[model samples]
Target: MKKWLKYSLISLVILLLIGTSWFTYTFFIKEYETADENVDNIVDTDFEVELPDTLEGDLLDKNESTDKNVNQSKNESTKNQNSQGNNKETSTRNKEQRDTENDNSKSTNSKTQTKDNNKETKNQTSNKNELTKENDNDDQTVNNSPDESTNSEEESEKTQQDHVTAEDIKNRYRPTFQALQDQALAKLNNLVAYAYSEYKKKKENGEKVSYGYFYKKYKSAAKELEAKTDATFERLYTSLQQDLVENGYSKDEASDVKAYYNQKKDERESRMLSKVLDKF
Candidate 1:
C-alpha cells in the first residue's frame, strides 16, 4: 500500500503540472499574440468607422450652424455694447450743445442790455442838452422883453398922433371941397333943365326934334362941363394933398377925402340925369 500510494502521488503531480502548463500557454501566450495581431491590423488596415454621406453632410452642417450661432451671439453682444456706448456719447454731446447754446444766449442778452443802456444814456444826455438850450433861449427872451415893449409903445403913440393929425387936416379942408362939389352940382342941374326946355320947345313947334337927339346934345355939353369940373377938382385936390403933407397929414388920407368928394359928385350928377329923363 505504501508503494502504490507513492506511485499515485507521482502521477497526480505530473498531471497537475501539465494542466498548469496548458493553461499558461493557451491563456497568456496565445491570447496575447492574438490581441497583438488585432492591434497591428487596426493600425495597418482601414479599420476607422465610416459615416453615411447624408449623415456626414448633416453633421458638418450642424457644426457650421453651431459655429455661426456662437459668432452671431458674440456679434449681437458687441453691437449692443456699441449701441450703448453710442447712446452715452450722444447724450453727452447733447448736454454739451445745450450748455453752449445757453452760454451764447446769455452773452447775446448781455450785449443787447449793454447797447440798450448806452442808448438810454445818450438819450438822457441829449435831453439834458435840449433843456439847457431851452433855458438859454428863455433867458435871452427875458433880457430883450423890456426893449421890445418900449419899441411897441413908441410905435403905438406915433400911430395915434398921425391919426389925429390926419383927422384935423381933413376937417380943415372939408368946407372947400363942399363948396366945389355944390358948385359943380348946380352947373349940372342948370344944364339938365336947359336941355329939357329945349326939347319941349322943339316938340311944341313941331320941329321933328327927337327927345333922344336933345338928350345927346345935353349929355355932350354936360360931359364937357364935367371934364372941366374934374380937371379943376384934380388941381384943387393936388394942392390940398400937398398942403396936407406939409401939415403932417399923409397923402393916403388926402386921397381918401378926394375919393369921398368924387363919390358925392357922381351922386349929384346921377340925380340930375334922372330928373332930366323924368321930364322927357
Candidate 2:
C-alpha cells in the first residue's frame, strides 16, 4: 500500500509541472506576435501622413509659378498700350505745327499782294493828274491866240516876254515862296517829332500803337497848312490885281499880267511841294 501511495503522488507532481510549463510558453508566444503587429501598423500610418504633406507642397509651388506668368503677361500688355499712346501724341503735335506754318505762309502772301496793288493804284493816279494838267495848258494857249495879222507882231513881243524864262519867274517868286515852304516844313517836322516821341513812350510802357492815330494827326496838320497857304495866295492875288487896275493899265494888259503871276505862283508851289516830298 505504501509503495502504491508514493507512486501515485509522484505521478500527480509530474502532471502539475507539465501543465505550468505549457501555459507559460503559450502566453509568451502570443504576447510577442501582438507586439510585432502593432509596430507594423505604426510604421504604415507615419508613411501615409508624410506622403500627403509632400504632395501639398508641390501643388503650392505650381500655383506660385502660374501667378508669376500671369503678372508678367499683364505688365507686357500695359507697356504696349503706353507706347501706342506716346506715338499718337507725337503725331498729333506734328500735325498741329504743320498747320500753323501753313497759315503764316498764307498771311505773308496776302500782305505782299496788297502792297503791290497799292503801288499800282498810285502810279495810275499820277498819270491821270499829268494828263489833266496838259489838257488845261493846251486850252489856255488856244484861248490866248489873237488874229493872224496882229498875232505876228504880238508873237514877236510874246517871244521877247517869254524869253524872261522859268529862271526869271523862279528868281522873282523864290524868296516869298521859300519862306512859306520853310514855315510848312518846320511845322511838319515838329508834328512828326511829337508823334514819334509819344509812340516811343507808349511802347516803353508795353502799350499798343495804332497807325490810324499817326495818319490822322498828319492829315490834320497837312489840311491846316493847305488852308493857310490858300488864304495867303488869295490875298496876294487880290492886292496885285488892285495895284494893276490903279496904275491905269488896259483890262487885257492887267489880265495878262495877272495870268503870268498866277502861272509863276503855281510853278513855285510845285517846286516847294517837291522839296517837302523829298524830306518826307
Candidate 3:
C-alpha cells in the first residue's frame, strides 16, 4: 500500500468519529433538560398547590363559622335536655305534695267525725241520766204521800187477790196475748227473710260477707223488733187494764198480767235474735 493512501484513510475515519460524538452529546443533553423541566412542574403542581391570599382568607372564615354553628347547636341541645329534666323534677315534687295534702285532709276529716260522734254520745247519756232521775223523783214523791199507809194496806190486799186470781187472769187474756205474740213473730220473720235475701245476693255477686257485719245487722233488727213490740204491748195493756177493771179484776192483778206477758216478750225476742244471728 502507498503511504499517502493510508494516511488519507486514517484522516477520513477520525473525521467520522468526531461527527458521531458531537451528534450524541447534543441529542442526550436536550432530552435530559426536557425531563428535568417536567419533573419540576409535577413537584410544583402536586406537592404545593397555592391559592391567592383573598381566597385563603375566605376559606378560613367559612371553616370558623361552621365550627361556631356546630357548637351553638350542641349547646342548644344540652339546654333543652336540662330544661326537660328540671320540669320532670318539679312535676314529681308537685305530685308528692298533693298526695301529702290529701292524706292530711283525710286525717282531719276522720278526727272531726270522731269528735262529733263523741259529743252526740255524751249528750244522749246526759239526757238518759236526767230522765232516770226524774223517774226516781216521781217514785219518791209517791212514796212520801199522806195516804202511804192506806196505799200499803190496799197493796197487801191486792197482792193476796193477785195470788188467788192469777190463773183466771191468764185464761181470760191468753188469747189476746197469744195473738200479739204471733204478730210480733211474723214481723221478725219478715225482717229475717229480708236479711237472708240480702246475704245471698252479696254472696252471688262475689262479695265477701263478714260474720260480724251480719251479726250486727241482725242484732240491730232484733232490738228494733223488741222496741216496737214493747210499745204495742204497752198500748194493749192500757186497754186491757180498763177492761179488767170493768170485769171486777183488781188493778194489781191486771198489772201482774202485764208483767207476765212482758217477760214472755223478752224471752221470745232473745230466742229469735240468737237463732237468726246463728243462721247468718
Candidate 4:
C-alpha cells in the first residue's frame, strides 16, 4: 500500500507542475498582446495631438476674418451716418435760402402794389381837380356873358309866366329840351366838319366833282341825316305835343304846333343838307 501511495503522489506532483506551467504561459501571452494594444493607442493619441495645431491655425484665421468683417461693417455704418448728416445739413440750408427768397419777393411785390395804388390815387385826384376847374370856368363864362345872361333871364321870366298858365306843361317840359338842342347843334357841327373834311380829301385826291357823283354822295349823306334828324324830330315833337295837350291846349292847337315845329325842322334840315351838298 505504501508503494502504491508513493507512485500516486509522484504522478499528482508532476501533473500539478505541468498545469502551473500552462497557466503562466497563457498569462504572459495575454500581457504581451495587451501591452501592444496600449502602445498603438498611445501612438494614435500623439498623432491626433499633432493635428490640433493645424485646427488651431484654421480657427485663428477664422477669428481674424470675423473681427476684420466686424470692423469694416462698423466703419461703413459710421460713414453712412456722416453722409446722411451732411445731406440733411445741405437740405436745411436750401430750405432756408428758398424761404428767404420768397420773403424778399413778397416784400418787393407789396412795395410795387403800394406804388401803383399811390399813382392811381394821384391820377384820380388830378382828374377830379381838372373836372372841377373846368366846371368853374364854364360857370364863370356863363355868368360873364351879358347877351347870354339877358336871354337867360328873359327865358326864365317867360317860363315862369308859362308855368302860371300851364302848370302841367311846365312840370313836364323841363330844360332837358335845351340840352337836347345843344346836343343836336353839336351833332350838326360835327356833320359839317366831317363833310368839309371829305370834300378836302376828294380835292386832294384829284377826284372829279361830277354832278352824278355829287348827287350820289349828297343823296347818301341826306339819307343818313334824315334818319338821325327824323328820329330826333319825332321824339322832340311827340314830347312837345304831349305837353301842349296836357296843358289844356285844344287838340287842333297841339296839332298846329306839332305841324309848325315839324315844318321848321324840315326847312332847317333841307337848308343844312343844301349847304353840305354845295360845299361838296
lDDT: which is higher, 1 or 4? 1
List candidate 2 stretches off by more than 4 Å: 1-174, 249-280
The lDDT leader among the candidates is 1
Question: Could you give candidate 1's per-residue lDDT for residues 1-280 as a string of tens digits?
Answer: 9999999999999999998997666444432211233222222332122211222343356556555655565565556556655655665576567557655665778766776656655765676577556556655655565455456545554554454455665665666667667677766776666666767878889898644455445555666666766766777677667766765667787878777977987898789868976887
lDDT of 3 by residue, 1-280 (tens): 6999999999999999997776655443223212223222322221111211322344356546555655565565556556655655665576567557655665777666776656655765676577556556645654454344445445554554444343454465566666777766766666676667778889999998755455554555566566766766666667556555654676666666677777877777787767676766
TM-score of 3: 0.36
Q: Candidate 3: misplaced stretches above 4 Å? A: 1-172
Error of 2 at 30 (Å): 99
Which parts of model 1 are misplaced by more than 4 Å? 1-164
Whichever of 1 and 3 has more TM-score, that candidate is 1
CA lDDT of each prediction against the hidden true structure: 0.61, 0.50, 0.59, 0.53
Off by over 4 Å in 4: 1-164, 167-182, 208-211, 240-249, 277-280
Measured with C-alpha atoms, the lDDT of residue 122 in candidate 4 is 75
TM agreement with the true structure for every prediction: 0.40, 0.29, 0.36, 0.32
Highest TM-score model number: 1
lDDT of 2 by residue, 162-211 (tens): 44433333344335544554554454455455556666777899987654
Residue-wise lDDT of candidate 4 within 207-262, one digit each (tens)?
85444443344344445554655565556556655555654564454454445546
lDDT over C-alpha atoms for residue 116 of model 4 = 63
- Residue 157 in model 3: lDDT: 46
